[model samples]
Target: MRSIRLTRMDWRDPAFAAGLTLFLVIGTPLVPRGQGIEIQLDPLGYTLLIVSGLTLAFRRVAPTAVLAVTSLATIVYYYFAYPGFFQPSAALVSLYTVAALGARWTALVSGAALCAGLLLISFRPAGLPDRQAFDGPLWVGGWFAAVIVAAETARQRKAYLNEVEQRAVDALRTKEEAAKLRATEERLRIARELHDSLTHAISLVNAQINVAAHLFDRDPDRSRTALFAVKDASKQAMGELRSALEVLRHDDEPERPHSLRQLPDLVKASEQQGVAVKVTVSGDSPAVSQHVDLAAYRIVQESLTNAARHSRASTVSVDVRYDYDKVTVRIEDDGEADSSSVVREGVGIRGMRERVAALGGEFEVGPRPTRGFAVKAVLPLGRSEDDNGGTA
Candidate 1:
């Protein structure tokens, strides 16, 4: 099947029609024959001139067709030896429209053909004399060249403006895409923080709640203590959750970053779940940036949480070593570990790795040779305080 397309034009624009009407009215008059020349307007020449103007009126609708029709009429006008010194203005108008609106090759070919026909007419034996033979063609060709040059300049200017508009549209689209990506990343970071903060404390609470329920009837006093421990863990989890959510608050709201000083409290909280943890701090512990502080806290939190939840171990040891330009954190559990399963990581381990990696650091987690699981991270301190870290 063939497809048909419809187009609309503003016929209300009277510029072309009005100009054509004025040109026909003014140029159709004849000069009385005199001074070795006989100039008279015949019926055929007047009709041809009217036809050329009518064709020029529709030039914008089909410029190539209009140019061809007007050029043919012009050739006929000169062929019959019409007595007029002025070439048809309609032909020049049609040529200009074609050169400005039509394809480059079509405009060039039409202009050349029209000019060549005019040159032929200029050399007609009974027409312009020998001395003035080259005058008509030179004047007409130069004027045609000027019109073509102006049309080409307009086309180029139009193309440049279109290109600039396209580039602006592309830049806007790119900026929106970048904003969406940043929002997505912020959501992921919030999710990881929520998990890291709540997971370990919830696990501790679950363990304590189970103990309290088991001893509720038989040992009332022990059950009361277990319930109190549950209350403490839940309260701590709530505090950390509120701190993490502060990121979504207004700019004036103060943000709480989990600092290295909180490591002792984290270890004490893990001990409340019946697992013993020994923490050691070595080297001079200097003040760190906010991102590094938060990342380090999350790393230790996930490590101890994993020990409480997965590793059936009695005790875990944490070693923190701070140097002039780096901080290293290592957590090891004296738990029986499956070498095969240890090689495979879960979300907690991945989150720790992502945090360290965002700071251009090194992270490792696996089963130790003897019979335990271990996680170690070496974080560089060369970046500025303004720099931030990422989550899994």
Candidate 2:
């Protein structure tokens, strides 16, 4: 189909000119050439033919002007009994030129004028014939039909091409929009991962550094412990970052999951900084979705980090309660009476809330009844059988 279209376009201009020339040459032999009832071919008739040919050459460049000049010459030739073929041939080229150049009204009016000229030129005033001679109306009507059909075909073809071009443009725009949407989603996922990993690690390091700074002179051994805690936090941060990068580089690799099973290491790391965290696992840990487990782990991490940063709390409690169909986590600090004063809504709290919300869960963060702030989260564990199977 594409090759055919290319061929048609390649030959369109020359084809139109060639067709018009053939029509004129074929009519030449049919011209009546005798003495009595014959059409006379005089100098005036030759002049009209030359002018019509010149006008045909300019048909595509200036269709209306060519049609007008040819029509006027035909009318003058009628005064000297010239042949009727010249006007109809010129009008056919004029109709095609107007259609190709996006001038539909010009094509229509020129077709009408050609039909009128053919009618006048073919009329014989002498007598009616036994057999009908091809007279005015037949010639006029035939040329009108041919010209109008060609012009309408050209117009429809142009409209179809325009529609195809518009569809291609729309498809390109939709593809670009989808690509932009995917890019935005990927960025958001990366941001959430960074918040969960880097922020927790940084908070732990900051707590250890503050402890080491305080104990540098009085207790060098305890200060050494604080330094070790900072080292562990930094290593864990690098490990998580590397894991994240690995997934980015190789999408097919299975992601390693973070869960509450790692909570002991988290507390010991904080205890090294002189912050005592009391951990309790009340009910059997239910089987949970990977999304729910990750959210639970992040909530505890952010809560403990917040307590270490903002409270003079000597005792922090990390509690996990697992039910048949749900898991609940609660972190509370029993520190200075003014611990709640330092707690404010920050990115960590916002991210924890967002994570819990993503899993059809609920999160609450505010001051506890006794003292200090508490962070609590509850997540569904799917069916009871799944939750029981998840027990470890």
Candidate 3:
């Protein structure tokens, strides 16, 4: 009786109880009278039958009381020498309800009590301690045991089904939460990738376009160089964008992985945009992780883009230093020192900072010491052994 099957609304309880009561009230009296039946059922016997059957209406609500009332009514009716031999159906149902409600031992004991009491009515002087004398009690015990077994079986089935359904709901909820987290992470990755690559390309193209337009009338040769720079910048931008998108198309790793080795190409591209860059490399470089290499490269690239776009300076300095535990990249320009010309931090600056921070690094961008703007980033290699073993 450790389980219950009450999982949904039951509107049929009242109707079912009423029908059962009517069936028992009408059918019990019609049962053939037993041998040596001395008295016919009177108003008292009819009252007891009605009381026993009516008690079944509240079996689930008050199973113990219902069982008691029905068992008592059946016993009393029999003790009075009623002619009919049929025990009340309500007694059997209430016994089953008690067990179904998780009182198996209690229902079994009650069944024994009912059998003992009913056995007295079946005993007679002529039936002297024989097989027939025990037959009535045995039948009662058999029916009670069967009812308990059936009720217990049904209750167990309901419990198993409810558990299965609960597990399914929990699994689905967990799956949905995992999916939402993955989507959020993917969005961040894509946004960071596009902003880092495309912003640099667009800034270079803008610079070359401005140069070409200004020199179109004054110097055809210089203007043609500027136009070629514009075309190259556009092509590199598309190529980088296509490469970045290819990873998404195949849902695979990046094909053209970034490294500090690309710093030369980055410097050349900036020079083509009319910025004279002098790069300085110091210290013995050590093997570093791919993320560290990539972060260093992007920091330098974005700094060049920023200097080209914001400052009036022609010559910018790019510096990279390799240390035992970290790599640092610094870019500075001789732009005008006027406070009004200083540009505020935007998406490009923020993206560079984000990249450094993600690697547990340091980032700095501001006006230079005397007459220019500067950007610097320091990226740490956190692990003992690193992947790619890429140069810094």
Candidate 4:
């Protein structure tokens, strides 16, 4: 019961209590009959005032009904020459309610009705004196117009506020969707990087383990060398994996740039896997854009990994040439005539192609005319100026 009381128009609402008090005070006959003002009430006059004031208790609930009932009662009182000002004020309250919540046509019709009713009273035999006829209707009509205007303004203001809130909600939803898309792209990039970095090293380690197992009894020294190679490959693979993961864990930490500087270590890793690799770099190593440098490194890494896994080549040669405007990388192997077919254009080849193409570079991989496979990439060079003040 207490909860229901709180939900309804209880005494806790200041507006509800205030409206009731105001109507009662103004509707009662308090003015004395002097100075051209009179308060002479028959039984009908007393009833009209009390009913008009009491109906205000439900003004918000049934505004149109209260207006109709109070207006009729007041009209009857005026027709019989009752002396009071309460009923007219009550009618004005009803007019405001209709303007605020009712349709435009309905409020306009109600306004017209009040104007016509007041005009009839003004022209009646017991109506206002000749001196007040002009000023009386003007003042009353102006006050009614003001009430309607105020109600319309409040309605428009409420609509404008609702529209503004909806726009803010839509903008926030768009921002959240964009953030999720970015997170998804970042995850895919990390997966691709991890796959390219580890597959070759792990493959080499597996080969060394097989070699050691085969030679264990026949040649203990040769077996020991193979075992050492396995350990080295395993450690190197772990170090590279940790580097990739550290970049993922702390995004703010700068990534170590992979370039020609790491080429010697890469060649040595392949050599341990029983492939003799010859590396040659002609011309100076010029500073290039970060993306270009990284693309170049990844292309070489993928090519070496593929050659080690597929080509039965005893000798592989890598030659890098740095021109004024571009850097060219070429890897060749004297393997079987079908060595190129061994390295299919799968995920590893596709990744290298994408990396080079994204930086506006050229990439090619195919079989040599005589015997062997060759992978070549030509990457464009740019001034190494990063967003940070230092060189890229």
Candidate 5:
């Protein structure tokens, strides 16, 4: 692709040189000149003019070389007193090309050499006036100076256009990076929600299944209650699944976001799983932002699920404290752990830790010094909407 682009550029320069050469060849004879004695057009004069015009095709690639060749040829043609004079169009173009290409010193030095060489011509071409000498050189130098200023202007404008294009590219790259990061964070959030909801709901369903199978013959009423509990757990799991999948719907409809306000329902679900739960709240939950609220509730749910599934604790205690600057959560169980066995962190425990840490909270989970297991977290508040996907 790059070579093709360069080839195209090469084609354009030759076309431009052809136009200027054709103009120099035809326009010289047609344009009227003042009354001055002149020698007829000869083969050598044509050679000089043609040589200068040909050099212009390489102006962009070798501006200084083209400038030197054309400037020398134009001075030689006029100094020998050709029939009519022609403009140094090729030389002028080469000088402009150098400046426009941002080679400032090369343009200036090459232009100075061109003007100086032309000035030395005394216009002694078959008895020409000395005053014509001054006028011709002055006009050429003036035109060269004007070309330099114009080239500088064009170069500055091109530079500005390049800068604007670069800025646009940078902004687009930054936006793409931000979108990728957001997608990764969103995937993590969805995973945590799924783990918490499914683990807790499935634990209740499994426990009820065991109860219903065991009591079907001995206690029909209790067995029916366990079956009803299984149905409710499945229904609640469906609702939670829908809620977690709401983002894919891309709607303005409200969401059933989890919060500490729903702890009673969470506790009842765990109790149904055969683990007694006691929840204590120290501060009002209304002041907590929804992100923090969702995180806190998921932490509690994960804690309860781990207790019922791993610890097999008969009783669990949950404490939530909302203070001036932060909220604290502590869950402990009474089930005794084996002294020789090592406790491993499952997906539920890791998900709980991630949830708290994402909210800038600190989390810890391990066997207690005296008894069973404990999970505690401290989540600071006052995060802005922009920080948490426009949720306060």
Candidate 6:
């Protein structure tokens, strides 16, 4: 029972209570008397008027109950005398309550009741003049119109607030989704870079170690040289792995630029694994943008690494063509099947594809009809300068 009362109290508004109080106080003297030409407040009549005024204090907390009590009091007082200001004042408040509580149908029914009560009071055995007679239909219609307009206004305001809140929630959700997507993409890219750089170096180390093991009994000097190559390859792989991991862990860390200048080092690094690489540049190459240059270098690096690991080819070609509008890099190996017959694409190829797509370039990797696997990349060098500061 207490909980039910608390729930009803929660629905009441302080503003409605205040309005009811003010109306009742100002209209208290309007209580009528018999032969209503003169003002007369008998003790009993004044006490009932005061009770009606006090009812306004709980108007919002119990609007329907307050309205019924006030209406009944007004009918009894006027039935013994004539119409008064308190009756109309209570009716007006009840109409406003109907609008405030969003009870349009209740307001309509109450208005009809008020009209019928007024008509019965004004016209009994004989009808009064136009000034004294009640305009039941007109008063009912006007009260209902005012209540509906007020209720509709309240509904529209509530709807507008709800819409604003929904939009804010949607915007926050969208930002969260975008951030998650970016983090996932970054993780995938870092994984690919690590695989491409470390796998090739580790393969070289393995090959050198095998040679040293076989030659240890025949030629000690050659075996020592092979062991030295294995140590060097292991160190190189560790360095590349650390660098790639550092970039992934700390976004603010500065990265050294890798470009065409690093091609010689890359070629020598692959040679340690016994895979010969030849690089050639053709055409009066257009000046490469930083992004395109970096992309071109990585493509060559990943492709050579794949060839060394998957294709048992002795010779691999790195060809770069710089034209007026675009720069293209091609890495191809001669026909030689490696130990593994099933060709598998590691994260390296996926990273390469993402890189090229981000730069609005094209990447292709597959076996040539005549021979071994090949990787081809074509990037628009002219637009690279414009995309320099842009994000993918």
Pick by lDDT: which candidate is best?
Answer: 5
Model 1 TM-score (2 dp): 0.82
Cα lDDT, model 3, residue 324: 83
Of the two candidates 2 and 5, the one with more favorable lDDT, higher being better, is 5
Deviation in Å, model 3, residue 303 alpha carbon:
2.8
Ranking by TM-score: 5, 1, 6, 3, 4, 2
Candidate 5: Cα lDDT at 205: 95
Clash pairs (backbone) in predicted model 1: none
Give all candidates' CA lDDT scores. 0.77, 0.70, 0.77, 0.73, 0.79, 0.71
Give the least accurate 10-residue stretch of model 4, judged by summed lDDT.
1-10
- Select the stronger candidate by lDDT from 3 and 4: 3
Pick by TM-score: 1 or 2, better one: 1
Candidate 3: list runs displaced more than 4 Å. Answer: 1-164, 282-287, 311-317, 323-326, 330-346, 353-392
lDDT per residue (tens digit) for residues 6-37 in model 6: 11443344454556545555555554443444
lDDT per residue (tens digit) for residues 1-392 in model 4: 00100123334334543564466455556755432533477777777766766666666666668778777876676666666455566666766766666444555666667667766776787666777654545655777788778877876787688799998999999999999987876675566577677887788888888889999999999999999988888887897788878868886635656777888878888887788889999988777776677777777787888787877788899999999889999999887756335456888888887777867889998888778889899988866745344432
Could you estimate the TM-score for every candidate? 0.82, 0.65, 0.68, 0.66, 0.87, 0.69
lDDT of 1 by residue, 300-341 (tens): 999998988888878999999998888999999977785655
In terms of TM-score, the best-performing candidate is: 5
Pitting candidate 2 against candidate 3, the one with the higher TM-score is 3
Relative to the unseen true structure, what is the C-alpha lDDT of residue 97 in candidate 5, on a scale of 0 to 100?
81
lDDT of 5 by residue, 19-129 (tens): 877777777777665646556667887777778787888876666677778888878887776655565878888788877877767777777776777667654555447
Error of 3 at 10 (Å): 2.4
At residue 270, candidate 6 shows an lDDT of 78
Candidate 6 achieves a global lDDT of 0.71
Model 2 lDDT tens row, 1-392: 01101112234555555565565545654766422333656666666766666566666556667778876776666545555455456656666666566666666766677556645554557422424434644665676667767876876898799999999999999999999997776666566777778877887888788889999999999889888888989999999888778767875544556888989877986676567998899887656666677778888877777677666777799999988778899998876644335456777788887787877888888876668778899987753333555442
List pairs with backbone clashes in candidate 6: none
